[model samples]
Target: MLYRLDISNILFLDIETVPEKEAFNALSEEKQLLWEQKTKYARKDEFTPAEFYERAGIWAEFGKIVCISVGYLTYTGENRNFRVTTFYGEEDKLLKEFKQLLETHFNQPKHLLCGHNAKEFDFPYIARRMVIHGIQLPYKLDLFGKKPWEIPHLDTMELWKFGDYKHYTSLKLMANVLGIPSPKDDMEGSMVRQVYYEEGDIDRIITYCELDVVTTAQVFLRLRGDALLPHDAIKKV
Candidate 1:
């Protein structure tokens, strides 16, 4: 079934996020108390709420997406090319741009959204943030009534799991085992907050996010027993 699906119908994507505020004290006092309650168990006797604040980006309510990079395949006869684009800058602004792309181009029932570990992270985070910003949920992101098999979404990590619920794999590890280039060569995910907030180097982060999108598409092709994309085949738009 995987081989039968058209690669062009899939929109491979990745997102980079950071805490909503620059520091714990930047949040409202009420929100700070809520944050403590929210992470109480996870940081129990280990790290204070202020200390654990670095990971707040993992939760949509506490974080904001800084970038969303998407890639899709185009075919001219047998020649295939992957074009990548990024919607970035202000959170609400970027989310609106990303929503436009989905509604304008990838709204078909046959279209799919793919990312590494997207089911657990990227997909839901985007949806939640969209709602928070009062942006209408796009059809592909709105899964309120769809049955499990009816959702137009794909997770490379879930596919690799092969029903092993106990198993977990990082994108770097999966790319390594599958012989795809590692996207983390430039910087680690943990540094995104610092890079964005401190260094104010969103261009660097954008490049990193785009690389992950390309690598994810490559992983999908490899999983389908197809040829990996050549370096020249990936073009940033």
Candidate 2:
């Protein structure tokens, strides 16, 4: 069934996010209280709100998206090529650029947004952030009244699950198991906040994000029993 879908209609993507502020203490008193209240259940009296603040990027309200790297396949004659582009920098600008990309090229009903664990994280996160920024939701991200089958979102992690709801697979793990190269040689998701806030290197993070997008596309191709694109076949634009 996966093989039946057109590769060109699928937009492979990955995002990198960081807490809205560099430190938890930098938040206003009201926001600090709100964070504490919001995370109490998850913290379970173990870690203080400040201690758990490192994971704030996982929540749309407390975080800002720094990069959204996207890729799609193009066929020429008998050769297939993958091209990647990244929208990065200030959150609002990046979001606007990404929205424009979606609105322009991938707005068709048949186009699908593909990511690793996107249904659980990336898809909703992007939608919520768009709302916060007062940007109109793109056709693909706006899932308000759409039926289950009508939502054109593809999650590589969900596809690999095959209905085992209790199991979780990281993109790195799936790549390793499937013989695809892991994207996290320099930094993992755990280190994104530090790299963004302390190191102040968004280019590094964008590179990491782009690699994940490529790995995700490769993983999808592997699932369809197709050969992975050669290194020279990948283009950055």
Best by the TM-score measure: 1
The TM-score values for the models, in the order shown, are 0.98, 0.97
The whole-model lDDT of each prediction reads: 0.94, 0.93
Worst 10 residues of 2 by lDDT: 181-190
What tens digits encode model 1's per-residue C-alpha lDDT throughout 3-61?
99999999999999999999999999999999999999999999999999999999898
Model 2 lDDT, residue 79, Cα? 95
Query: In order, what is each prediction's RMSD in angstroms?
Result: 0.9, 1.0
RMSD (Cα, Å) of candidate 1? Answer: 0.9
Q: What value does the lDDT take at residue 204 in candidate 1?
A: 92
Residue lDDT tens for model 2, 1-237: 999999999999999999998889999999999999999999997999999999999999999899999999999999999999999988889999999999899999989999999999999999999999999999899998999999999999999999999879999889899999665458888899999999999888988999999999999999999999999999999
How many clashing pairs in candidate 2? Answer: 0
Model 1 / residue 207 / CA error / Å: 0.9
The alpha-carbon lDDT assigned to residue 160 of candidate 1 equals 93
Q: Tell me the lDDT of model 1 at 3.
A: 97
After the best TM-score superposition of candidate 2, give how far the Cα of residue 141 lies from its true spot, in angstroms.
0.4
